[model samples]
Target: MWREPWPSSNRMPFTKKRKLQLSPEQCSDFYADQYGKFFFPSLTAFMSSGPIIALTLARNNAIAHWKSIIGPVNSTKARETHPECLRAKYGTSDLKNALHGSESFHAAEREIKFMFPNSVIEPFPSREGIEEYLSRYVNPTLLHGLTELCKHKPHNPCVWLADWLMKNSPNKPKICDGVTVEEAE
Candidate 1:
C-alpha cells in the first residue's frame, strides 16, 4: 500500500522483497495478533488464496507518506475521495482492499520480523561507537599487517594478507574461552 518517490531518483529505496503464498494457519497467525478474532477468518482466507508480494521500503517518515498515498481503508471511499490512490483502482471493499501497509514504525518492524524471521533489524551504530570499534578492533592491526605485506611483497598478496590477518587478529577465538591451549587440548 505504501508508495514513494522513485527509488532510482534516490527518495526511497526498497530494502527487501519477498514473494510468498501463505497457508491459512500462517495468515491467521499474521493478522489475528493485531486485528483480533472478528476479522481473522475472512482476512486469512483472502490472504492465503494466492501469492503475495511483501516489500520493505526505507526512508524517513515512510509510514506517514505511505498512508497518505494509499488513502482510506475503504476502497469505495478511496474511489470517491482519492481517485488517484492505489485502493481506488485495485480494491473491492474494506476487507478486500488490495494492499497492506504498516500503521507505524514499530508495526513495520514487527511485521517485517513476522514476514522475514531470519532478517536482523537493529539501529545503526552511532558515529562515536563506529570510530571506537575501528580504532580498537581494526586500525592498528590492519596498519601493521599492511606494512608487513608491503615489506614482503608476496606474489600472492591477497592470500598472504588473509593468512596473516587470520593468524594475528586479536579477536580470534581461543580453543576454549577460559582454558589455556594445553588445558583445552
Candidate 2:
C-alpha cells in the first residue's frame, strides 16, 4: 500500500543541502571503518546530486522487508539475481539505485530523525507491544482525526481521547420492530 510522501519536498530551500556532513570519523562510526576515505566523497557527491525520498514506515520487521524487496545495493547484481525486485526493475545502476532502505533499526531511527527533525519516534517495540500500543493509542487517534484534539490538550491524553471518540462515534440506524424475514423457498 502506498502511503504519504515526505512532508517537505527535496528541492525546497529549507532542505536544499545535507543537514549534517559526516566527518571521516563519523562515517566510520556509522558505516563500518573498512570503507576508506576515497569512497566517502563520491558517495556524498552521488547522494547530494539529486533529490531523494525518505520514508517513515511503521510495521513489523520493516527494515528486513524493505531491504529484501529492494534486492541489493548493486542494481546489476539485483537484476541478475532478483529480477522481480524494485531495484532490478527500476534502478539505473549500482550508484543510482531506485530506492534506499536502512541497514538496521538503529540506522532507520537516525535517518528518520535526520530527515524529519521535529518527528519523534520511540525506540522499536516488540511485535506484541507494538500491536497493543497501536490498538490503544495510535489507531484510534488516526481513525477519529484526533490530532488537533490531542494537540490542544497535549498534557491530558485521556481527556482529548475520550472527547474525540465521544464526538466521532457513528450513529446507529433505527430498527423497525414489525419487520420479519422469510426463508427462500
* Model 1 pairs whose backbones collide: none
* Best model per lDDT: 1
lDDT of 2 by residue, 1-185 (tens): 11123333222222222333444444344444336666665555555544455556666677787778778889899999999877787778876667667877877777667666787787666789989978876686566666766467667777767766665543323335865434232
lDDT of 1 by residue, 1-185 (tens): 22221234323467887778889998877776645667778888888887887777776677887777668889999999999877787788888877788887888888999888888887767789999999977998899999999999999999999999998877765466777454221
For each candidate, the alpha-carbon lDDT, in order, equals 0.78, 0.61
Q: RMSD per prediction, one decimal?
A: 6.7, 15.6
Clashes of 1: 0
| Clash counts for the predictions, in order | 0, 0
Window of ten residues with lowest summed lDDT in model 2: 1-10
- Residue 3 in model 2: lDDT: 15
